[model samples]
Target: MHSEEDAASACAHATALIAAGRLAEAREVAETALETDGPEPTLLLVVARAHMAEDEDDHDDDAERVFRRALDLFPDHVDLLAGYAELCLRSDALDRPGRHARGPVLLERLRELAPDSPQLLRATASTSVLATAVAKGPSAALVQSLDLLQALTTAASPEAAEKDARRRAALAPYDRRLAVLDATLTALARPGRAPLRLLVRRRPEYLFLAQLTVAVLLLARHVLGPFPLWVTCAVVVLLQLPLLALRLLLRGARARGGARASGASAAGPAPAEPPLPAVRPYTRRQLVLIGAGAALAFSAFVTTTVLTHLEDIAYPRYEAAAPYTFRGMTRTDTGDELDTTAASDPSGRVAAAFTYFYTGGSGDGSELAVTASTGDFHDATAAMVYESDTLLSSTPGVGSLDDSWRADAGAYGGWMQCSRYVEYITGEHKAICFWADKGSMGSVSFKASDMSHADVEGLARTTRQTVLLPASSDS
Candidate 1:
């Protein structure tokens, strides 16, 4: 109250309280400000409104006194004049027959000052002239209708007057609904309302879209590749679930403001609308369901992590298989590499693999490998040709020969991915065949001099027979 800033804050708080239907509290705040802050128009209006909201009868209401005081400061204030005029009309309706009543005179004044004033326009309807416009009410536009509502204070017969006053009182409240609507509209123009409207209506949708977009991107997996992107996305979804839960916890903290809030009008029933459904927290059932989903999501993440770690550690699990043999050639140098470091580059990760270097009588040689791991053999082969860092540095490739390639893994057997490449000035063929059956997985890769597509297929089949079959069947 000491400063304009303080007064404005008080006014905002009081208005909010009023909007919340805390009229008694609103009145207390407004009244305190009026007494201490000297006379500010907005504060006066609040005080008057708070008083009008509480007063039940047309009898001498305290709202009138506050209105008069506010008007003394800003006499032409559109809201003040309209509010005061409405109160006067209601007051005069009861045959309080002292003057045609101040309502008519005030209306005539407002008619000039703010002719289209929502309050003034509304008050015009309540004139006994328009009272007949309300069905089953007063019969005629009395109060000296000839002079145009101004002669409401003119003397009339006691019997006729008493009858008309009774009619006015009954018809007053419902008569000026249009004005109430207009006044309510005018009140809606205020600060911070647009943002609240967005929060209550549009922001939730945006949050859902953002969450969906993130989920889609994560699912695509081009970014943040440490974990299975799908699982990571699930985890992210869970993180955002609380807000997203609203529908879509928005299933997150949902801004579910469904019904609109309103209080009764002071001047002829302030416009009212049925409330929107209220914003609510998740119910017990909803919470339980969310908790169940969260538990599952967390469990999946843990399970995926454990499996991935197991894969990285899968190295020493695969029994070292014997190298294959060919006519007039021997697996002269054979060795294997097993990478057991978890979270290292999984793409190039050879959990366990055996490589055979074969030497023929004419110094012709080839390399063959059988690998078992969680990493994809397809990427391994592709990355080898492209020399991408995703593959192991030692991964072998006949440089720039990736163009000649064909693949055919008929459902029953892993056979047939062959490529013809030139190496050491000799045309040769390479074959990579991969297989996955439930928990069993591995791939066969062969590279040799002068090997044709048939040779590639034959070697792939022989490699499978050499590595995957029982030792006795290798014969």
Candidate 2:
């Protein structure tokens, strides 16, 4: 029953507000039109436009907020649906948390409402895997995304009733984009093409550093005592290794290819005379194999370094060393060595201790684990204890280790529990020992302060000896 004039006026005002960077105002106007006229697709479309405008103006949160609101208002609307899908895609690209929070459900809704929209189908193929991963697991997400993409590729094919030329033109761009993506991937897969340029230049240095650092981290996390310095150093080094390896592999392959090609051409038939010796050009297969083997070796080295350190990453003890004294299961606030056997004589150096304990479910009914912080990492002193569980999951716990806790005196950062572990050999225990002293130069003035990894590790070793180790053990 809505007239053209009413719809036009509402849409015009909405568009003008959007143009003037008044997204919130535009949304209000569009909503007013919907209230007055009842379910006008164009008005809903205008509202989505306003959301997009808001997103462009650095108000992505507001944009998504408004998009969701408008979708709620017009659930069966396709244009609005497409707008939502595009917003989800953009959100994922921007790494905005919870962008795909509602993607799978919304995608399912779209399938039921507008099953024929190619863009929706394409998004399902591309975005669903990640969406599902965020909402579920990686394996499930990947499988779903692939299925959607396959379905989309099939659905968008030329229908039998269409004119060949028109259909080809209509489908040509989509085909070309897919082809370009495949070609780019193909080029990347040709031996040494994995964006490893940085790694290539410093391959030898990186591999050596990676191996040494990994060993140091293992020693600290498992054998010495968990020191933040060791864990942080290991992470930065690990990230750089792959980049360096890719670079080295690419460079080495190029150098070998150039040498082989030059050697072959030089020894081949000259302009006037055939060569007395038959020179052979190396097969592409051989070059590929060599490049692959080199890449594999580099990968193996990095993987070995990563895995070896992971088993015992939690070096949780970091208090001044104390004398060993066992007194019938006495527990200290700071982890002290359990030498409760007798009143042991004090030694010259303090003892360091690293302990790992898991507690959950009533003594044993059905079995459930409720992980809790051991307070070792929460110590407000200068001693920082770095801890990680079996999986190396890196779950953001009750604290910030993301280089944001460098400031605020008298407050130490808390530990994060990571469930995502790799190659965990159950029942195998690991610990590291180290200590550190907070120097004036080590003090931080802000959240983004850069502390010396080496100094921290050294201090950690010292601290471990003072606190976790028993002074009388050596005696």
Query: Best candidate, TM-score-wise?
Result: 1
Model 1 vs. true fold: TM: 0.33
lDDT of 2 at 250: 36
lDDT per residue for candidate 1 within 223-336, as digits (tens), equals: 334555557557666646543332231111111110111222333222243121222343466455545555554555565566555544432123345454664556655332
CA RMSD, predictions in order: 21.7, 25.2
- Give per-residue CA lDDT, model 2, range 107-200, as digits (tens): 7778888788885775575465565335322332222223223322344332321233224323332222222222222233455543442233
Off by over 4 Å in 2: 1-5, 12-28, 38-41, 56-58, 93-95, 118-475
Summing lDDT over every window of 10 consecutive residues in candidate 2, give the lowest-scoring window.
Answer: 439-448
TM-score for each candidate, following the candidate numbering: 0.33, 0.24
lDDT of candidate model 2 versus the reference: 0.41
Cα displacement (Å) at residue 338, model 2 = 52
Best by lDDT: 1
